[model samples]
Target: MKLTLIAAASTAFMFSLSAYSQDMPGMKMDGMEGMKMEQETKQAPVADAEGTIKAMDTSKHTVTISHGAVPAVQWPPMTMAFSVTEDQLAGLKVGDHVSFSFRVKDGKAAIVSIKK
Candidate 1:
């Protein structure tokens, strides 16, 4: 009689455990359908470099700047001129303080965009 009770109790416990797991919000069940996972891919945030515009040449599509340190890339503040695409050079002027994003390409800093 004791062995029969023990077997019945164990079976009950197993059934309850399975039911609880199915009700859990985070649990995934095998052979279940219609569960759509919303996974998002996030891009890396753009790094900001701030400084005063030292010089700009719209014709040459280049700008010189003396900027504060950029913490994202561990860059120290220095005065340097960078090349920009002709389209990127629009509406920029020398001596106008600005913030910008750039990446070093072929040992030269290439300007991506300028911010007022």
Candidate 2:
């Protein structure tokens, strides 16, 4: 009967879909992947910091700062690159002292603001 044929076809389709999902890259069978992705996207709060500009790359829009200890984030003095805006780069040069605010996400840092 048509009803019997239809039921068999539906079962086969479900099996094929399950197999396809398992074979795909980054496809999740469980729902925990969503939770992991959410955690990765969440970033720490912005912290106040101060340091000297060790290097600057106007073309890359990045600056390397040899910053002092950041008590708010418990970070020790170190030189690291930070993404910056064109306005932030204006008149700025290496070895210049700067007081700035920054946030770290996915192990990269960026300058949020710079104080004159």
Candidate 3:
């Protein structure tokens, strides 16, 4: 009985491997290699956020903001540092309330526009 079970398992494994090894005809249309269409990216839409500036680093051109809940990305209220241009940092200070728009990609967020 044990030998039969092992044979059955090995047979199943070989069948699965063969199924995957078989190439689909549609995968290579007209034999065009390396000319595949650009895969669509799931870029998140820009989200408006409200937060208070908790800290800033001119050298890094970034600000630490404690923001409210963000529904656009389903993120809970949290404090995170966001990258911004030096020009955008002008006229901004710590402890000031502000509104901003930002986009997140690859687990990183950048402030697109900000104003107090």
lDDT of 2 by residue, 21-115 (tens): 78567756796645656667777789888889988888898999988999888889999899999898887888889999998877888899985
Tell me how far the alpha carbon of residue 77 in candidate 3 is from the true structure, in angstroms, after superposition: 0.7
Best by lDDT: 3
- Candidate 3, residues 1-116: lDDT per residue as tens digits? 99999999999999999999998876746666656565544556899999999999999988999999999989899999998999888999999999999999778898999999
> Ten consecutive residues with minimal summed lDDT in candidate 1?
37-46
106, model 3: CA deviation in Å? 1.0
Candidate 3 Cα deviation (angstroms), residue 51: 0.8
Error of 3 at 95 (Å): 0.8
- What lDDT tens digits, residue by residue, belong to model 1 across residues 69-95? 988877798898888887776776777
Query: TM per model?
Result: 0.54, 0.61, 0.65
lDDT of each: 0.79, 0.86, 0.91
Question: What TM-score number comes out for model 2?
Answer: 0.61
Which residue runs of candidate 3 sit more than 4 Å off their true CA positions?
Answer: 1-43
* Ranking according to TM-score, highest score first: 3, 2, 1
Error of 3 at 100 (Å): 0.6
